[model samples]
Target: MAPEQGTGSRSGCGGKGRGRGKHLPGACWDTLWGDHSPPHFPSGQVVKLELLEQVQAQLRDVLDKAMEEAAQSYLQPHRKDPPTQHPSPPHSSGLLEVEHFRTFYHIFIAMLCVFILSTVAVDVINQGSLDLDFDLFIFAFGCLPTVLATWLVMFLYTLLVPYKALQLWAGSYHTVRFPRLFTAILLEALLACHAAVLGYYPIYTVIQHQLPAASRFIVILKQVSFLMKSHSFLLEAVPGIIHAKPPDGEMKLPALSTYLYFLFSPATDQLPSPRTPYVRWKYVAQNFAKFLGCLFYSYFILECLCIPVFTNMSKQPFSIKTLVLSIFNATLPGTFLLLLSFFAFLQCWLNAFAEMLRFADRTFYKDWWNSTSFATYYRTWNVVVHDWLCYYVYQDLFWLFRGRSRVAAMLSVFIMSAIVHEYVITLCFGFFYPVNCSPSLPSSEVSAGIQVCLYCQEWYAQIHCPLEQKTFWGLVTPRSWSCRS
Candidate 1:
């Protein structure tokens, strides 16, 4: 017999001679040879067994190659390609043509003109001469230097410290055992330090020094915004550094210029590099003009509506009638303020920066005014911040739970957002006024119910009112009335 046949016989006969009558079972021999061989053929069995091994090896190679391809695709979806840009809805003038926006602009300009005429008329009636002063505007922006200095300090710390710490931790991660735990502890400590300096100190200064409302607003808003930005930067960048395998076998930190751009970019999340189309100076100039226009619009709204009505209501005794009237009055200005804020920051301000930087993604605010649902409103209102919260907070929490508890993850996001909102308001106002009730409540169901009731009221009113009446109301009426209760 040949060597291979002899080896197969020994294997089938339990490593002994067949004279011992200790041969392998007939079923095992049949399985190895039955498909192509005669019933008594041992040589065929060896050939079939070798063929099966070869086929198994080929399958293993194919599976490994498939897995590797899948992983590569997932990890590098963009793969050095330019980011896809979602253009804003069609606009003849590049601004969203929402209903009543132009009408409101005209009305505000007229109101501002009326304000100047009225002030001059009153001066002529009393002092007999026009004495125009901008003391109110100056007062509204008091302590400007202090606010800027505070912001500059916060900006520097955020720019330098957290990023450096992240780099340090990421550099050490690969060589060290228990790197995840060590890096986590390092991150927590850095956050603790940042919180003490930027978070607590600024708030304490606002309260302790009794800063003016405008000054306090600048400080507190900057504090909160910078904190969020820094957190997002670390959350986004550090992971890339940690997992990256460079050809040189050394991790490289992201460029300072890229990070600085991210800090100033209208976007809340960090990108490796955002797309920059060729800049049009005209577009940039137009957006800046609109930003200034919105600022003036907001100022007039506050001067004409909020101050006069809210001030008078404060001095009067509290009664049901007065309370009801105050709410009705507050609604107009409140809604105006809301709209102004939305347009000014999310649209005009962000777009100006985006255009100047040649950043192509300009779909910042969607047509949120047309949203029939509160869920849609939240998503469409201010996408920059919403994107950050969804990615860094909500998605991370969902991932931590292994995607088993979606409701829990969503609730956690709402709770976190509410807390931040309340914290910013309380710190800015230096008071314990929980103006937002939804945030205070633990149940997301309650929050959703509130939104639903508000939506229903608006829907009902629109259904009942005639087209002309609806148009009038849409221009003048405030949605804040629905939330008064």
Candidate 2:
């Protein structure tokens, strides 16, 4: 009976081994699909692939989380994964509202209207022969004072009042209702339209008659004239005259003023040839060089006349050569003459600072201290323009924002002065727009770029927060799209 039992156990163990061996490690799927499996099928292998894929997916998720954590460690709090673009609150002092600008526009328009209407009335009442002119020097005389008084208030308010209104509008808890602001905007628009109509009607006839080309030329000429009259300081007589106003009855005249008044006055002084100043070799040399420059320019202009080929070409149909010669002939002598005139005028007008001029132009040929080269020359040679720029631009900036930051104030003032300087030049010489001189000339991208850069520099300096180098770069660097466009 024991032998029979042992045989049965051995047989049972052997039978179990055979069954286990027949079942492949990955054959669970095969068992389920065995009845459905067709010839040449590998159901067991397919099950193995499916199990491998599941394991890979789980491992991939774990690796991805690790990589994400590594990336998060290097990123700023606001620049994780999707990146945050949190909008900063508008600066308290930066922007003026639409309504505030409108109010200023209206007030200025009203003041302008009053001036125009009054001027027109005076003219018509005197049968069109009546004329009104403004002089900056004689501010106290004539109707000038009345006009200036009103205009001064208007101008000052335009600068200061709008900023105050903007401050109020931007306030959080203390905000009053802005119905007045809305009302002001509407009133300004109406005033602007009316003013436009009034001014346009009077000048319409002449403006209508002018062809676009002729008008452009006229504008350019006017702009050039304006530059010469307004910006250039070589002609110191104009500046001196601008600065020299007769002392008021109530004010005491300074000693220098009294002497200048006497010297320039029509009255004859009882003669005393007490002191004859020593002659300056430097002055003599400058005058001689200036004379030579004039001679060369005069001869060059006449030489253009002598060139019959160029003269004949002007009458012929336009070609590149004809255009070139015409422009060259016009510009070269003109530029030379302008330089010559600048030099000549310096001597004739700057008699007060003769020694300084001599030293700057001749003795010290160093560019930094010299006054005969470029814009720097104007500032150094003729201090009047420098003083004006300082008084208007620099001083005003200091007065407004000096407490905030000295460097910022200086930069703002400098940029403002530069823009005003450029603007005055453009207005006087109308070279900004196409056909401002030549229809063939493409628009002045270079000049426009200069203007934009200057403006941006000023704007950045005015509003940049402390330590915001990013903001500074953003303002200065042109975007890719901006360049392409």
Best by TM-score: 1
1-485, model 1: which lDDT tens digit per residue?
22125554445435332221113345444545555544343665656655654664577578879998999898975646433653442221244455577786777667667766776787899999876565656776777877788888888988888878877887777767898798879978997989887878787777777677668888988787788888888877776776777555667677778778877877777744346545556766877787777666666666665556554444443356755565555555556556666767777777778767767666676667676665676687777778888988999999999999999998898778778876776565443334454432222333433332233233333333324444544534523332232
Worst 10 residues of 1 by lDDT: 15-24
lDDT (CA) per prediction: 0.64, 0.37
Q: Give the Å shift of residue 185 in candidate 2.
A: 26
Which lDDT tens digits does candidate 2 get at residues 1-485? Answer: 22124453243224322222222222432443465643343667556645654664567578878888888886846533432432222221111124774574466446445545665686788776655442311221234333334334333433343333333332311233664575467447534643443223213422443323223233333332222222222122223322433343222212333333322321122121122123344644655664554444434333333233333432344345544445544453344334334444443223223332221222111122233334454355434345545554566567787467767766675566556554433333222211222222111233223332223222223232223354656544422112211
The residue ranges of model 1 lying beyond 4 angstroms of the native Cα positions read: 1-93, 96-111, 245-250, 272-274, 438-485
The TM-score of candidate 1 is 0.66
Candidate 1 RMSD to the real structure: 15.9
Model 2 residue 20 CA deviation in Å: 99
Kindly report which residue stretches of model 2 are placed more than 4 angstroms away from their true locations once superposed: 1-335, 352-383, 403-485
